[model samples]
Target chain A: MANITTNPESAGGSLTARALREGFYAGIVSLGLFVLFVGLETTQNIRNELVLRQRWGLLLTFVLVAAVGRFLTVAYVRPWVAARKAAAVARVRDESAPDSFFKRNFNAIAIVALILYPILAMLIFGVQGSLKWVDNFGIQILIYVMLAWGLNIVVGLAGLLDLGYVAFYAVGAYSYALLSQHFGFSFWVLLPLAGILAAFWGMILGFPVLRLKGDYLAIVTLAFGEIIRLVLINWTEVTRGTFGISSIPKASVFGIWSFDVGAANNFAKVFGLPMSSAYYKVFLFYLILALALLTAYVTIRLRRMPVGRAWEALREDEIACRSLGINTVTTKLTAFSIGAMFGGFAGSFFAVRQGFVSPESFVFLESAIILSIVVLGGMGSLVGIAVAAAVMVGGTELLREMQFLKQIFGPDFTPELYRMLIFGLAMVIVMVWKPRGFVGSREPTAFLKERKAVSGSFTKEGHG
Target chain B: MAPETNTATDTMTNDPILKVEHLSMRFGGLMAINDLSFEAQRGEITALIGPNGAGKTTVFNCVTGFYKPTMGMISMRQASGKTFLLERMPDFEITRDAKVARTFQNIRLFTGLTVLENLLVAQHNTLMKASGYTILGLLGLPAYKNASAASIELAKHWLEKAHLIERADDPAGDLPYGAQRRLEIARAMCTGPEFLCLDEPAAGLNPRESLALNELLTGIRRDTGTSILLIEHDMSVVMEISDHVVVLEYGQKISDGTPDHVKNDPKVIAAYLGVEDEEVEEVIEEIEEIEEGGKH
Candidate 1:
């Protein structure tokens, strides 16, 4: 086979012209999909006279942005990829060099920031506006951070591609919701139960799918998640159908039930805190912070243990793992259950935090977002997962407040609607740029004389 | 087919660690292993040598619990005096409980893991429990830490024996081909198996590495008293390390004896040289003279 190497100079073309030519082709495709399809409906306004007027300005701007973005990407990304490939041989050897400062200290800095979340929230957003920032960015991102860490065990360490992780999340949420609503179980009481229930479901899903691997395993897991969702939606008597179970109850602080309080009898009032939703939001933030920390601590410890090594071994080569006397069945099941257990903790926390449990929240998109967080964060990396969760989840939330874009794109522009579009673009760009995400370097769980962090170059995306 | 009364020529016959009785493995209509019986004696090296597709790997797979034979039984006697039907158990149970550890024909080290971690993973069952199923280990409990330290010591010991101690912290994939092969054997040995099954351990090794492998195998037998069943195409390795040689031709055992006895066997030479029954004696004489000269 002849290897084809095309140099820009050999091609005898200007970079801008080449990029513009490529961009023009990509722009045509984008224009067809965005302007002719998705954007057309969004821009149309059927006013009082029943006239279908098109917002041509927004459509044109969208096309131009897409074209320009593609042009710059074509111009820069290609050479960058070529350079990365050129350094590939040396990179693997250089990977085991002493831990780079950023990868080593990212956790300490992140933890300090996380520890001071409440104080930081107070300073940045203030008492009145802190609730939104804390609840949406802090709690929401932490919940996902916990979820990604959980999924990391299965997809990252075990090399099991699970597309139905949300099933376990739903199991946790519903376990808390149903237990709380039907029997009036308190949040503290149902917390562990939710985890146990989700783990049980994880095992149930794990058992029948032991024979599957790679893509087949992913499909089965995806189906399992959908089944859980479909069951939740159809099992109307228990789940209340699509209406969802609401007003489930807030998480109690210090095991003392918050229980039905209106100002005078409010727990927050008694504690000398403001008797507003901020109190609940702030309480939930701390609760999730504790939960997320627990997940990280456990995951870090497991990585160095025998069970953890078995998971990585199985990921490396199942046949080799089995030949070496590692019980793959138990290893895989434990990965699923343990991962689901953390997802369950996050899920029940979600229930109490939102005071609502719905099939809508446990959609496939939720699984995709969580999976993306794991992948985007660098699989098997706890700090990376946390960072990724904050970037992805917090980035989407920030988009809602991107009203400043109205100055350029017109007042009709809602940045919120382009969340998925932006997310998809960001994912592609990140994948192209870093493939391994923020902290791709991995410090060997067990080492001999020298302790060096191995870069992602030595490990596969799914491999530990 | 008769349940092991005894055969006269059973070398190292103090106790047979592994017994294959009329084990026939059929893949659809194809019989990979015919009704063949053999015993690997305790604390000795047994080599299964055969031509390509002669089902040497098939026998190894069946013994290691990777395959379930269509007919007959593979019984493995553990060091604890408990006998296990390997065909009945899962792959891991054969390695764990039955104390049978194996290496692949192609090296299958945990490429992403460090050399030490690869060996540590082979000792998974012991450390997994000591870690209290990861709970105490996660908490940095003393007992689990001690177990982890001990396992690392064991890993280091094997790494030293395999001459991989210097590269213990290196990723297994980054090692050279010969080193990876040695690492795979060391990893399997770290499992503390009573019976070691190696498929082509010296397959791609250079002359020096092959000599090192022979020493490693001999050391395992002499020091650890591990009964090894090896499948090798390298005649030098088989003749030097193996106490008993079993030759297969089209899934049937053609010759079984000490290396010299098999080297002098007419049928063995005929199978290797692809000759008629009448021409076997002539070829055997010719091959024996050459083997004698090649020995030096």
Candidate 2:
């Protein structure tokens, strides 16, 4: 196949071999930097006493190693790789066929995988006590996935930059917390209410910035998020301020029994087995999974609908959208409101799960993380966003258990500090390697016959 | 003047669909459209031709609600005798309610979307109307499904009309420049608008594309009873296709007549020649001398 043509210039030559050579050189440089850092920290005792003021030698060693690693890669590895890429580009003079079968079938495979995953977990690990695996990895990932999909509606579908997505999440969580606590409403009752409340807030946010565009809109949304957080913090009478509202009701077993087995409740009586938190976890998993899938399904359906297409039209070209008779203001408002509604759903689920509502929970960093998930996953891509969240969030969480890395870097070394550095590096690499996204395809909302995924291609800057 | 009066009476008897009454749009100190008045009759191709930056697009934009004019009223009368104040309505309402549609100078297809999707998006309001905007419709109600099916069929119909059926699945961006221009017109047509305003439809089209575009515009006017207002630079396209021609110079109306009359107007000739008042006589003398030399 045509896959072997790595050197875009030399169609006949071994392009893969060149890529291998470049990868090998990069590995050697990284290894060399690691060794040098170890030597400096252990033997040479080089120190930077001024900067961090804690462990001078270790800090200096890290700094030097990072600098040298980056410098070597930029000076040698990057140029060498770019030259090969240039060669490869020349080889592929006749642009390849735009469609790929693999890309087209990606969603089909993803749907199958999503369906099979819980079943496999139940079969292998059993459904009894698998909270750690199911809740942490599966449910948590799906929550972020839902949020990413929601934000995708605004940023990807509508081309409206919103930095206060977490505000909706806060609204949902607070809605659930306050309503459930006050009225003793079940999860199902609170869920829709929370979504509505969040949508209301979304419309409220939409009205002010109806005419704003680009960075100005982004700043306004960002300030709006901060204002919401501040209000939650200052409103001690209702929200209880920073102390937060605790003992928020957890989702019961289909309104049958609570997880608590005191004089008040008993799930064991209904199921004929001892009640376990695992039931709650499993139930929560399915609940959130359904919600996430609901978000995805609605988004897909909407895209094929008039409003969805209008959003894309607005995103692509606002001026043209207006001329087409698409009410851009209403279109934008619908996008924001819908996106916030989903965020609210995820937030309420979170509040119910944690049994708490704290201002600290809904932070700018959470919004950044969610936005990063959307960006890293690729805009308007459902599967890509989920995968990005899994990699980013799950990877960071997985890093906490890396006890062996401590042995290599000595007792005091923590990998968490390097997480941001690694994330930054990954982002830079992703930008250089796949500028569009990992699963870069401008996915269509609806398909003609069978839904086919389109591979992402480079769009002109102004167009995107 | 008596003959002019007779022709004016005949034109007025046709009953103008779009009436602009002393529409004056000023941008600070500059008058973009100064006391501009015109009438576009029903089921006719009205050509608005002008030099670059001559307020041709400004008139289109103001009519289409992209820009709110500083002064005057734009009244568009439908076949049903329902009148819409174009300036008073919101942009979307103008399209959704008033049934006015438009195309841009630069072909603005949702490049990322497929050829069919672009047309389907234009039919958004119609589909929404069929669905009733309820949760049942969202959950794949039979009516919604039928409407969606009809939408795709309508999209395919327009795509075929535009000669882009073979490239239906292709991303609109991948199409050649001329194809994109035609696609933009097809998209506007999908909306089923009473009046379609085209801004520089033949700007960058090759001769063959221009001919094809002429056929499409004529076909639309003939078959659909859709009035067309076109702003174009291609003299061949305008001269061959336009029923009525409105000429603008320096953001002001210099000539308004049929294609034959506008073509023969001295002011129109002088504007196209880019000649001053003093040079007009000299140029005419030079042209006569050239004709005399050719004869000799």
lDDT of each: 0.85, 0.82
Superposed by TM-score, candidate 1 places the C-alpha of residue B43 at a distance from the truth, in angstroms, of 1.3
lDDT of 1 by residue, B70-143 (tens): 99999988767899999899889898899999999988888888898899999999998898888777778899
* Model 1 per-residue lDDT tens digits across residues A96-200: 586688766877887887878877787787787888888888888888888998998898889899999999999999999899988988888899999999999
Spell out the clash pairs found in candidate 2: A7-A87, A7-A88, A8-A87, A8-A88, A8-A89, A8-A91, A9-A87, A9-A88, A440-A456, A441-A456
All candidates: DockQ: 0.62, 0.39
lDDT (Cα, 0-100) at B58 in candidate 1:
95
lDDT of 2 by residue, A150-212 (tens): 999998788888888999999999999999889989898999999999999999999999888
lDDT of 1 at B278: 59
Cα lDDT, model 2, residue A291: 94
lDDT of 2 by residue, B1-296 (tens): 01122232146456688988888888899889988889898888899998888899899888988788998899999988999999888777787778889998777888877777888888877777776753556777798889888888888888878899888877778899999999999999888899999999998889999999999998888778888899999999999988899999877889998888998888898788776566878989999999999999
